[model samples]
Target: MGLGAGPPAVKRRSFTRASVAVAVAVGLVLAGACGGGGGDGDGDGDGDGSLSVGVLLPGGGASRFGQFDGPLIEKQLKRLCPDCPAPTIAATSDPAVQRQQLESMITRRVDVLVLAAVDPQLLRPSVEAAHRAGIPVVAYDRLAQGPISGYVTFDGTTVGRLQGEALLKAMGTKARGGQIVMMNGATTDPNAGWFKRGALSVLQGKVKIGKSYDTVGWRPENAFVNMTRAIAALGAGDIDGVLAANDSLAGAVVAALNAAEVRPLPPITGQDADLAGVRRIVRGDQYMTVYKPFEPAATAAAKMAVALGRGRTVGSIATGTVDSATTKNIPAVLLPSVPVTVGNIKGTLVKDGMYTIDQICTPALRSACAKAGLTR
Candidate 1:
């Protein structure tokens, strides 16, 4: 996401023995702070230890936010504060619905909120309302504007760079003088702009951008329409590669190209490392994808939320600081992302415990999986 200044420099934070010890200590402190018995059980305005958390996500069901982030964050929260009330989780792609969810959390006077905003700008007022209610809002994945206490997400610029570099590498001889179509994410999410900027830094001089379109709502259908338009404007042969912002968009681009009957598919880049994206890579429809490990990100966000709930600063948890449009130098955890291609799928995705060999290698993809050296 775009910050007030330039993107913060991303330094890999190793989970050393000392870091683990610190994390344990922090968790213990939070547990002790929240284990007391007093005030209303809802953990509302009574100023008791009954920690209450609210989660807002962009989408649900098979999407990363649904399949991974939500469950992982909840799991981490329970581990940290077993006595705390079960968190209230809600998911929606509509900015209006997300705002209503935030308001509901505010009305309940939740201790803290972990939000993955659908539209950062649109949710600014709701975030402000949460702040007014003395509920600390931790911006998760997408940076929401307003007075947020902390933030946690993967390095968007790095994600874009990985996609751009992989696309160029996949293009091979065509890389010297190639034409590419840029299928970016939604305009409402600042991350879309952030990814686009980073990709342009690497792709501006190397390739000719024949067409570029920002897919509204980050929807695959929108991307498909845009890709079809690009094909009509710039013939399939002239389009050498596609720099799609995420896996969903990349799938749409691939489908559109296939529908147009492009003989040999062009190299396409994606992020999020969704299972479908990995399958596409094995089937030779997509070139690569960026995998932002969900465990670390969820853990970081959960810790930040719990600490804030206990009236503690996130100085111990945050690796760096980021400035949003309305908030300055907010405590932030900028995690790293890994690029996944057919060559490194086993080493990155499966080896990291994100997916099993059998999960990625379904019956239909057995031959392709074998060719890619992905076996039991």
Candidate 2:
């Protein structure tokens, strides 16, 4: 899905006027001039309720950041603090560029930052810099290193478990010593390792992994290249299943398989119930996808950001605690994820108002929709 438009509260402006590719700040409304400065706490360490939230996502455009997380965060922030200034939103997939954006935000001195780091370890120094500036940082979606104040995300372990379980079920007879290819996400993302570990816990003893590759930058093009190489190395026929990290990767895998003219495609697992991924499941191209409801995750991040900005403890809002490489016992809200397939598409995505029947079932997919039991 594509992003509709920037939130009405957003004010467009150049972030440091830097021409870094992929680094875009939706609007950088300075907090100092608007009476919503960061670390605006009283002598007793309690804030006067003035908030200026800054949001930074890993990517933009058709990515989840633009399509769901950004808008939902803005809405929730507005609901919680009506008088607060609009957040300074930014997105970039380049690690160096993301670090530059975070440094710029610190210079601007936003009250609290909501961050989904492109590369958690690469962004650690910048996160530390923000902490030293007395600006509380709330890590959203992906966890970053250094003194992060709060975190909100779906459990990566559970997401992988669901994907692994679904892939095995789809493989059926092949699940007994089946040889599969592993298309894992970028190593820069901590969640990638988390997901891979969770999936390996369930898949290791049951299946034989023929070829495995880590797609650099989590880029679809890289996935395609890797998949093509795997097809050439394994001769396509030996590959019984595929464990794709997400929907985008799954699409690339499918395309590569089709390019190799592999008839009767093997089962493929995916995550992030993107519209296209859901339709792929209906068409019997992909096996399943893990749906991490964006609303609750965004809302939780907004709540944590607001509380941190107001100089309040997040202990009450956090359901649990997580320890990062640098920080110990960090407050967190790890939500659950649901596995989506053709059978559960209606009850999960459609029933939750994520998509309409018309959206998933296009005119070209009429017969496929009928076969999948999807009807308006």
lDDT of 2 by residue, 1-376 (tens): 0010110011112212121111111111111011133442112222346578899999888887888899989987776677778898999889899899999999999989999988887888899999999999998978788899988876777778888898999999999899999999888787887788778888999999998888899999999999999999988788999999999999999999999999899999999888889889999899999987777777678777876876767775565777776777888776677788899888778877778999999998999998877887
**Candidate 2, RMSD to the unseen true structure:** 10.6
lDDT for each of the candidates?
A: 0.83, 0.79
| Cα TM-score of candidate 2 | 0.87
For model 2, give the 10-residue run with minimal summed lDDT: 1-10
- Residue 228's lDDT within candidate 2 is 95
The C-alpha TM-scores of every prediction are 0.89, 0.87
lDDT at 226 for candidate 1?
Answer: 98
Clash pairs for candidate 2: 38-111
